[model samples]
Target: MAMGVHGRRGRGGRRAPMAEINVTPLVDVMLVLLIIFMVTAPLLATGVPVDLPQSRAAPLDQQAKPTQVSLDAQGRIFIDDAPVAEAALPQRLADLAAAPAPPEGRRVYLRADRSLDYGRVMRVMGELNRAGLNHVALVSTGEDQP
Candidate 1:
């Protein structure tokens, strides 16, 4: 019976060792990362969430980085993530623009919430103009202006 058992455990009965890598777990991990990025992509767009009014304007491609000024729904102003007093905004921006070494283009991108009053937006623009940082780009999400 022992000899019979040994005979039964021959090369024919042996299975091949698995040398190939199972990619299912790797694929699963990659899919999980993809989902995480997809979910957080919009949130990572920029700080101070704003429902930007849409525009049919062509996309801008430029070499220089612009200074960002974002206005939230509550009318709070942020200059590159730093909150600024409305009155102090002009001087601060002007000083920042002229500091250390001036950038290639003194362009300023204004990100304003769609629900904000037009006058408020204009006022901010006026302030930006006062700062002498005149090249402005109005950021929008491409939704038609309602």
Candidate 2:
């Protein structure tokens, strides 16, 4: 009498190694990374906390990394999230302008708290202009954005 096990081996009675790659694990890993980044992306936008004003204007198209100048509700000034004295702001802006710039010039994003005095914000803008950093964009939240 002869007996054979069903679906366990080929005609040669030997198991064949799988040649196909299993992509389920790879897909699972990629999905996990995507979720992690999606959750963390907004938090990384800016280090300083400010109650930005709302505007109906659309967001600007950004081609390069621009310098960030922020003014908080307390009237504190920050350059790229680092605190800067008002007296030193002009010098710092001058130094930034002296650095290598793109053909369109170094772009600066000015973020001021909505509660700040208009004159204070203008003073910072004046400093930026005096330092030859003319390409300034006011950063504001969209009307529908939180």
Candidate 3:
């Protein structure tokens, strides 16, 4: 630093404490933080990682936290993140129906891989319907496919 009166001067020509603040470093740090968040934001979404079909339809007006059913490319089934065998899905869904008031709404979101067999997806839907869970919706990515 230069040994000169760069700040407010006192009567003896000695520089007083700088009352002004330097914001350059503050802005630099803030920009770095922004970039970090921008880089990491997309990585925070956790899910079954199925390639959802693209749709132009409007999003569902969700009334409650729906049950999540997922089907992978290999035809494995999942209920709310728990693996369920194909044969057990119907009975499992029926048991879920016998629960108290909340599960009665039976808002189910069916997420299947885009490459999944259409018949397989239909079979799951059929089971959900048979179990009195008619309020089912197929989950799909928006118009843009990643």
Candidate 4:
């Protein structure tokens, strides 16, 4: 060991040890990553466009994976990718509602094309409602959040 300023041995003649951990740079990097995620999270949720019919009712809070019924532009009805005849809708929904469920009740989501007739949509809703399926939902491309 070499002599230091005060004639005392000085850490094998090396420099003094680091007394504090440098965490400010790490915190800055983490904050930058957090800001990046906060900015991009909302943009990642883009969806298809549709002019949704509006009402004053609050959206339903559901806990189950709701059944999705889609009506195409040509007034064709689909229940989870299988084309469903209009005549068979009542029995189909009844069967689904009556089947064993996991949770959040026997709720259904109905997606009608924007070009479809309101009465047609209403009829589907009515049929499901009348079949004792009280938790039917009209699924649409919600309003653009600008």
Candidate 5:
């Protein structure tokens, strides 16, 4: 007779060290997430919220650095970082057009403070439209309750 304890198999199969990091799947998932964010990032913003006046206007198609027109709550107007008198808009647009480069396509972005009057917004838009800068986009903050 021999002692049975010495040669018995252990309680379970022997464990083996993991041989792979499996980074390919992780990298694929990360790359896909990065692409999704890059595609959607431009559609987001955060600031004082406003209910934008609605219109039947068609969406604009564009690919250029647009000229910006900003209106403060006090009804002051700024065009491309310079305060513009209400009367000088057309000439200013012309000046922008005369400047060098591919951005002079007469495109403009209109950003109005949420507290501003509708008539004021329309008036500024009208001025730029009359200046032959037919391409104008209203800038707005993303929907966020404050």
Candidate 6:
């Protein structure tokens, strides 16, 4: 019975500090951050607010960042979320076209409020075509999405 001063162990001394890392708390924090980002990511995608029409068409595959052109319910125009006067839109579009484009050419995304008249959307499209920005895609929400 070679008992130490504590009377429970042969080596009887202060226990060595644990070297293994506890990962439970780390995992918990990471999962919380991931969920927070997932919740806010969609909100940050576009700045200009518009009531998009719902469509059953599938989303397009994107290779590069496309230029966004948004038309609000009030018939205001915006390029990449920046407000542009209707008279200035053509010049802005032309400048965008003049910029070096990818091999597939520059792409434009048209996001118009569903409340807008069809002619308004077509006129915007027509302006884009005149500016040599023919690679235009109409932006819409999925039918199942809110």
Model 1 TM-score relative to the real fold: 0.56
> Model 5, range 1-146, lDDT digits (tens) per residue?
78565433445854555567989999999999999999777766554463674444565577776788999989988987899987787788777756764644556789999888889999888877766677787877655545
Relative to the true structure, candidate 3 reaches a TM of: 0.58
Q: Tens digits of per-residue lDDT for model 4 on 1-146? A: 89657533467876666679999999999999999999988887666453476444566776667788888999999988899999999999889878997655666788888788989989988888888888767764545465
The TM-scores of all predictions, comma-separated, are: 0.56, 0.60, 0.58, 0.55, 0.52, 0.60
Worst 10 residues of 2 by lDDT: 46-55
For model 6, residues 48-136, the per-residue Cα lDDT tens digits are 66445777787788788899999999999999989999999999999999999998879899999988998999999999999999888
Model 3 has how many clashing residue pairs?
0
Q: Cα miss at 20, model 5 (Å)?
A: 69
lDDT of 3 by residue, 35-120 (tens): 99998887876533644587788887766778899999898999999999988999999998777646346678899988888898
lDDT for each residue of candidate 2 in 1-146, tens digit (9 for 90 to 100) = 88876556776788777789999999999999999999999888866665557677777787888999999999999999999999999999999999999876789999998889999999999999999999898998878644
Q: List the residue pairs that clash in candidate 4.
A: none
Runs off by more than 4 Å, candidate 1: 1-52, 100-104, 144-146
Q: Which pairs of residues have clashing backbones in candidate 3?
A: none
Candidate 5: global Cα-lDDT? 0.77
Residue 95 of model 6, lDDT score? 96
RMSD of each: 14.5, 14.5, 13.7, 12.0, 12.4, 13.9
Write the residue-wise lDDT of candidate 1 on 1-146 in tens digits: 35543333437787566569999999999999999999999888866755457566787887867788999999999999899988888888889667653456677889998889999999999888877778888988776544
Candidate 6 Cα misplacement greater than 4 A, ranges = 1-52, 144-146
Q: Ten-residue segment with the worst summed lDDT in candidate 6? A: 6-15
